[model samples]
Target: MNWQDQYQRWKNDQDLEPQLKEALHNMNENEIEAAFSGTLEFGTGGMRGVLGPGTNRMNVYTVRKAAKGLALYLEEQGMADRGVAVAYDSRYQSREFAVETAKVLGVHGIKTYVFTGVRPTPTLSFAVRHLEAGAGVMITASHNPPEYNGYKVYNEQGAQLPPAQADQMIEQVNTVADELAIAVKDQSEIEAEGLINWIDEAVDEAYLRELKSITYRDDVKRDLSIVFTSLHGTAHNLATRSLAQAGFDHVFAVSEQVEEDPEFSTVKSPNPEEHQAFEYAIAKGQDVDADVLVATDPDADRLGVAAKKADGEYHVLTGNQLGALMLDYKLANMDDVPRNSVMINTIVTSQLGKAVADHYNVTTEHTLTGFKFIAEKIEEYNQSGAHEFVFGYEESYGYLVEDFARDKDAIQSTLLACEMAAYYREQGMTLFDALEQFFERHGYYFEDLHSLKLEGTDGPEQINAIMEDFRFNPVEGAIAVEDYLTGKRTYLESGESVDLNLPASNVVKFWLDDDTWCCLRPSGTEPKMKFYFAVKGETREAADERLKQLKDRVLERL
Candidate 1:
């Protein structure tokens, strides 16, 4: 049916919400056309969009539709009694969305475990597994600007529903129309029916205990003076308590950002990947004569750090650099750790990680973008007894030291980072100097990321076009181009082909001479096409220069 016809049907339906009808009455033709242009897409991660009064927007009604669909899907699986866990981050309507999800599940006769307040995304993942539930929901837009909010679905293993299963869920979401007609049990009814319960301190204690085991050297955390900031997100309480419990003496929380603020008023953006999020933490570090500064994203899954360098200046380490440092620390301090330990990272992460893993004689695995893929690998290793998973990270600021939560965990990462900083301090060296020493042992590898933001309906098409152009027209002076979507690698010079073992994605990568490579892929959660560049040289300047040139080339194509 045409979108306008669907809009007409919705308007004539008596069960549709009156407020939505009123909003539509004020909309002009173009606005109506945009609102009903298509069904809101549910991706592998789940639904995310701007909050407004449209079929495609994230409002009370749209959220109800998502919840109803999910509840129906669970009922179809014959596992509705297994229950579903729900948690929300500090974003607009997050708490409301959580309640909506719980009520919908309860209406379908499925049990629901809802966190009382905002919590990190990883904690939700852990809750799903801990409760042995059928599914989980996390209401968050992560590091995106304040205008957006998201709903993420998790499967039995506490990983995000992979693409194939997510597609089925999306079909269910599309099958619903009248959001007001969606039936949800009242909160009191749900609670009385024994389908709704609140989770609090017990879950926190269990997760923190699991995180504590990830610390290879808790002794090193004894006397660390660190400045920690949550960037006005959900990590304040747990991160601070974890540090103190791990025996750290002087953990300073940035007072301005400790409280949860949906607007994230302290920073321009809540993304830890950006330097701006660390501004307050950095200043606090200076004032307190701290050794290191750490900041977690709004969801508290990804972490970023700033350390005092040998030159008496502070340098904010990139995600790749921090991963390398942690890998080195874990490997060197592995006296009690098993010899068959393993490391995992996304394919687009810096090759320097691979180099560091190789130096320690540890095996490293590669996965696609999401940390769920890494979690899946950890599950695989645990079952097979193939290798002990030591650490996992992605260049996009996601890292995991243990399989506790089966996702990127800044709470654990923050504790480990401060311990690593203390270890460096004890040796009378800076993190920058340790990076330099690692460079001396291995080679200097510089990595850079470039994103092209394209909003609205045309955005995806533009991203596809750019990817298609690269796949057809190989980069200049490239040795091989790997097209992950097709699962094929075409050698530009040799004219040979190979198969890619990873899961399929609309991503294209080129391997240039001298270990320089560039990759192109669309943002899974945002309207952006991201480019990843990694190059190696003897010095930072030379490597940075090469990366800049390659980035320019990719941007031109984008």
Candidate 2:
């Protein structure tokens, strides 16, 4: 059906939800068109969109359709008896959507273990494995804005659904013809039938117990004065509690952002990737004379850090910098360096980490953009024993030190960052100093990311046009091009082609002269096209200049 007809159908429905009905009555022509243009795309990342009453939004009906699709997929796989785990963060309507998902699954005779309250995304990943569920569902948008919400599905391995399985699930989701027509049992009815199991502290304690194993040192100075903020998301309690339990004596929680505020009133955005998100934490850090400042997103799956410089100013570290720091620290402190140990990162990540891994004699592997790909590699290593997984990270402030949770874990990363800071403080150094040392050794590797927010009906088309333009048009000074969509790497000089040996994705990377590289990829979870640039030079000034030139040149073409 056309969007106009769909909008009218929704407008004429007598039994429409009151909130939706009100929203429909208030929407303008453009709003109506945006809402009914098409169904929200449910791919490997599951569904994420603005929370409203529309096929394209993240309302209860859309969520129910997703749950029903997952239910059908599970039943088809004959794994319904194994049940599914459900968790949500502190976003608005997150709990309601999570319960709605369980209800839909329950009506299909599928058992569900649902968290009673807010939990981090990584904890949900852990619950899938700890409960031995066939799959897992997380109601979150990660670090999206207040108006946004999302749904992410995970497989039995406690990892987000990889491409192959995600394709199957997407087909099932597409078969769900009508969003509003899916049936769901009442919460009470599901509870009485023993299909809904409420999980709380038992799982929390289990997850915390497993987290204890991530600590690498017992004698590291725990007196590191630290400032932490959850940005009014789900990690407020657990993050602070984990620090205390780890014997960190001087930890200060940003009081303004310590509670669960769905609106995230304290900050403009809850994403730890942005420097603005750490305003409250930075203020608290200065007040307490903290050795380091840490912030986690609403779902607590990504971590961000800022360290006090010698000049007494706080400097926010990029995701790559923090990843390198953590990897170096972890490898240096390991009692035995296994010859077969390997570190994993995405194609868009900086090569500085690989240099760090190389120094420790630990191999480094590259995966696609998503953490699910990294988790897949970890699972493969676990099964074949070809390599032991040490650490996994991406360029988007996501890191997983231990594989206890098959996703980026901000809680454990926070602990380790604190420990690393404390250890460095004992040597009269800060994280900035440590990072500078890495640069001096690794040739001043600098990196930056540019995200273009091409949203709405024409957004996808425009993004595709840009991708096509870059695919055929060779950039100046480029030596080779790696097109993940074609799974081929072509050398410009020799016209030789080779396989990337990685999963096919809509990503294009350029290898330029002077040890410079850049990548272009669309965000799976957001309506944005991201440009990642990295360069290496003998000095910081040269590296910074090269990085700016590369970034400006690439963006000008767009």
Best by TM-score: 2
Top-lDDT candidate index: 2
- lDDT (Cα, tens digit) per residue for candidate 1, span 57-95: 787777888888888778777768789999999998899
- Tens-place lDDT per residue, model 2, 1-558, is 888988988888887789999998999999988899888889888999998988888999999999999999998888999999999999989999989998999988999999999999999999999999999999998888899999999999999999999999998999999887889999999999999999989999998888787778888879889888889888877888888889987889899898899899999989989999988888898788888899999999999999988799888999999999999999999888789999999999999999999999999999999999999999999999999999999988999999989999999899889989989988888999899999998888999998999987689899999999999986677999999999999999999999999988899999998668998898777778999999999998999999999998999987
Q: What would the TM-scores of all predictions be?
A: 0.95, 0.98
User: Clashing residue pairs in candidate 1, if any?
Assistant: none
TM-score of 2: 0.98
Error of 2 at 420 (Å): 0.6
For model 2, give the 10-residue run with minimal summed lDDT: 212-221
In model 1, which runs have C-alpha deviations exceeding 4 angstroms? 1-31, 336-339
All models, RMSD in angstroms: 2.0, 1.1
